[model samples]
Target: MIKDIDKSDVIGPKSIDSPFLGSIPVERLSGGVKTLILMNNDSEHIFNASACGDNCAKWILKIAEKKDLIIRLGYLMDFGKDEFDIEIVNIGKTVHNSLELAETVLDNHLI
Candidate 1:
């Protein structure tokens, strides 16, 4: 996540080496990474996934593969072109890809 989202390297347990910002504490990471970390580690609450950008979608799906993840998105998040099984809790519909998800959201005014 540090490398992918921040373009930095994890130098230690609590430090990251960022080319733009130099060394910084883990707390100084982007909100998207922080949110992803919370979602990955915590299973007790639903996260507002809109805090994440499209770049974070793959990581979100990866986290879902490890556990049941429930998240709320204020807008449609492009989960790339790959096939994925994601249930729209609002309509109780399971969509397999971006097209299906778009259709479901449009048909139901979910977005």
Candidate 2:
């Protein structure tokens, strides 16, 4: 959690319905910006794209529910380096806040 952000700043794990059927649990990742964690297949992936607000999280989850779609999205996003099996995890919009970005990576763990 960031110092200035209170619990009210956080949303979901409730608000955004499960987009991948009953699989992925979406929640607000800690930061002043609107970031999210999408969990599925026993793994957690971060989501913070320019188009990816809380609602976009659900849309991404819905589109990439299948393995093939995940792979395609990863390639399109140029996530050519990471070894994660689920490539959809590599998709990102844009960082809304750099401080929150750091906190998300350093402090938050969706897993």
Candidate 3:
């Protein structure tokens, strides 16, 4: 996914190969990649989902399936039309699809 998004191949723990930039350190990766990495590895911290673009929504859902993930989104994130179970913590409701999510978000002013 990082490869697709960043156009960089992760070569090693601290190395990555960007087609245009040549070899670079991991620190040079985009904020979205860094945020996704943190969300994937550290289950103890609450991540600011606002740092991620809509592209990261699916990954966030994937991580949630593996472990409990609590994220705060400052904007509306399109989770696609496919059915998904997301508990809106603010409204105490579980939404199944983007439409439901949108309704819930507006009803609760979550975004």
Shift in Å, residue 27, candidate 1: 1.8
Clashing residue pairs found in predicted model 1: none
Question: Which TM-score value belongs to model 3?
Answer: 0.91
How do the residues 1-111 of candidate 2 rate in per-residue lDDT, one tens digit apiece? 211222333234444323233332233333322332232231345333442333333434444455323312211222223232232143342333434433443443421
| lDDT head-to-head 1 vs 3, winner | 1
- Where does candidate 1 stray beyond 4 Å? none
| lDDT values for all models | 0.91, 0.32, 0.86
Tens-digit lDDT track for model 1 on 1-111?
Answer: 868998999989999898999999999888899899999998888888999999999999999999889998988888999999999999898999999999899899877
RMSD values, in order shown: 1.1, 14.7, 1.3
Candidate 2: pairs in clash: 49-93, 49-94, 50-93, 50-94
- Looking at candidate 3, what is the lDDT of residue 51? 85
Q: After superposition, how far is residue 82 of candidate 3 from its true place, in Å?
A: 0.4
Please report the TM-score between candidate 2 and the true structure: 0.22
How would you encode candidate 3's per-residue C-alpha lDDT over 1-111 as one tens digit per residue? 578668889899889999988899999887887898999998888888888888888888888899878888888898887899999898789889999888889887766
TM-scores of all candidate predictions against the true structure = 0.93, 0.22, 0.91
Alpha-carbon error at 39 in model 3, in Å?
0.7
